[model samples]
Target: MSEQYPPPPGWSPPTRPPATQPYAAAPAAHPQQRPRQQPPAAAHKPGAIPLRPLTLGDMYDAAFKIIRFNPRATVGSAVLVAAIAMAIPVLATAALGAALDLSLATELTSGSGGESVTTSVDGADIAGIVGVFGSLALGSVLQGIGLILVGGMIAHVVAAASIGQKLSLGQAWAATRGKRWRLIGLTFLLGLTTAVLLVLYALSWVVVVMTTSGWQVPVVYGLISVPLFAAFFVWFWVRVYYLPVPALMLEPIGVFGALGRAFHLTRTAFWRTFGIALLTFVVAQIAGSMLSLPISFVSQAVLLGGVPGEAGVFVLVMGQAIASVVTAAFVAPFTTSVATLQYVDLRMRAEAFDVVLMQRAGLTTSGGNPRP
Candidate 1:
């Protein structure tokens, strides 16, 4: 048969087909597979500040932005409170000056036309001095109360603004109704503490001077005490008391609770808080001075040169009161905003408060999860 096949010209042996490779099934789909977690979304800013840990620039920018965000809640309320507080002082000053005929001006005569020069406080009655000091103390207390109340109102504004809500002046004031006295008491306590400490420091120096014979010990004590006490005061001011106003206003805590909250918030963040507050204060001072100094100088010159007696005193006092109101209008809101934002920032850094704020602003899922 093979010889017969070879005789066919075109006949050739056929090879078996190549073996078929086996088909590999895909690995069974993962059972109960874990879903990949999406990354956290970007910080949401529905208000003046971004809901995140804020930098110094962010705080300052937000503070200024707040002033423009709701003028009625900020500057208008500030001006109203300041005006009322200053009225009492202006009246007291005018009454006392008129009664005592007190003036701090000197008369000079250089020409030969029988000109005379007088340099003395002729009407420096003891009662007048007491009245003047008392008046000043009263004014300080009143101003402190006013400032605290205004700060409280502004805190409301800030809180609302953080959630992109604007408050009217009346609404802001209403928020402070239950908290006014607490804020005022806190301010008074802080001021009294500072005064007591200062008195003690002065007394220490006095004792050193009175008890010791040589100047060396007192000098050395002063050199040591001055810097040390100054540092202590600064620390107390920056790290302890500076934040209470915001805390008291924002949270449902009491006075001491606010104080403790402030202390806690400032922990591990003293330098940042201090630097920002100090810089803000310096800026405020410079701005206030720029706005008020020229008017003061003009009034003083008028008192000395042209205006006379109680009329001059009235002019000066009224001018000063007006200047205070104007300055407070611009300065109070900004300072309060900074303080509030600083509180927010510290809480965010420590407790993820940005998430809470975002949630409050309705930028989160109802399941308490942040929205992507």
Candidate 2:
């Protein structure tokens, strides 16, 4: 039997209709002319994550299980996430440029006598300002939508993969079909707001750089503000960490309610929650370093070996993106996996999941059999 594992604490059980294991009957086949040999029973394994209960290792195990069920999707998801995370700075630049161009826009490009301001498009200033700001806001919103869409997809894939079953791209898509857009919207709301706040934080840095003299001013500003920024980040993160995504995927919940639920669920377990999350992040970093070492060696070796037309800018960018994905992919699968694990862990810890696991594992329960 697989090892027995306990879920985390304070979560409510998924409310999936309680019953025996869901086993679909295979279709009957005709007596073939010369029927193929019957496959071994072991070949007919069930579930994606296997029948074992949850465990601390499940987070790491998810990284493997995702590869096992649908290697391609897992890889694809990795590429997608890596690309997005790497492109964050570029996106941030675009957002900031657009926002400034809108907010500080002028009718003419320059002043009359002393300045070089000039313009041709009449009434275009206001429109241009609106257009620029609109684009910035839209970009932020779109980024959020993209992430949430990807997050939900990743979540479904990881959840399905965890159970030791093969879910087709179609199956994975279908599992989230009904609520993909909703998830996207919810994510967008969260992301968009966060982006706005972050922009505010970043602008404070730029202001210090521009207004202050020499490097000392900027250094002083950074030193003083770093702790402030760090504190705010942690405070905000704790409130929203688990609430929105789960609320997006599971029950209907708003910003406040979802935050409340997350706070409630995480009560007295913040350190554990933060620890697992940190561990997941650390593993991804270590895995990324390991994966990128090969890429770096090859890239450098090619350059040193007198390879022609090597290290092209585009190639470098592409390679970097790929490298980033390689490292981050190690984390993405586990990211969603932890969400599910945390959910189930909370439920089991709170709702007698230990007993359920024992029953499911065929152990002799206190009541002779585990309650359904």
* Candidate with the greatest TM-score versus the true structure: 1
Span of 10 residues, lowest total lDDT, candidate 1: 102-111
lDDT of 2 by residue, 55-83 (tens): 56755565566666576565565566556
- Scored by lDDT, the top model is 1
Model 2, position 72: C-alpha lDDT score: 53
Off by over 4 Å in 1: 1-40, 89-140
Global Cα RMSD, each model: 10.9, 18.7
Clashing pairs in 1: none
TM-score for each candidate, following the candidate numbering = 0.79, 0.54
> What lDDT does each candidate get?
0.82, 0.58
Worst 10 residues of 2 by lDDT: 41-50
Model 2 gets an lDDT of 0.58
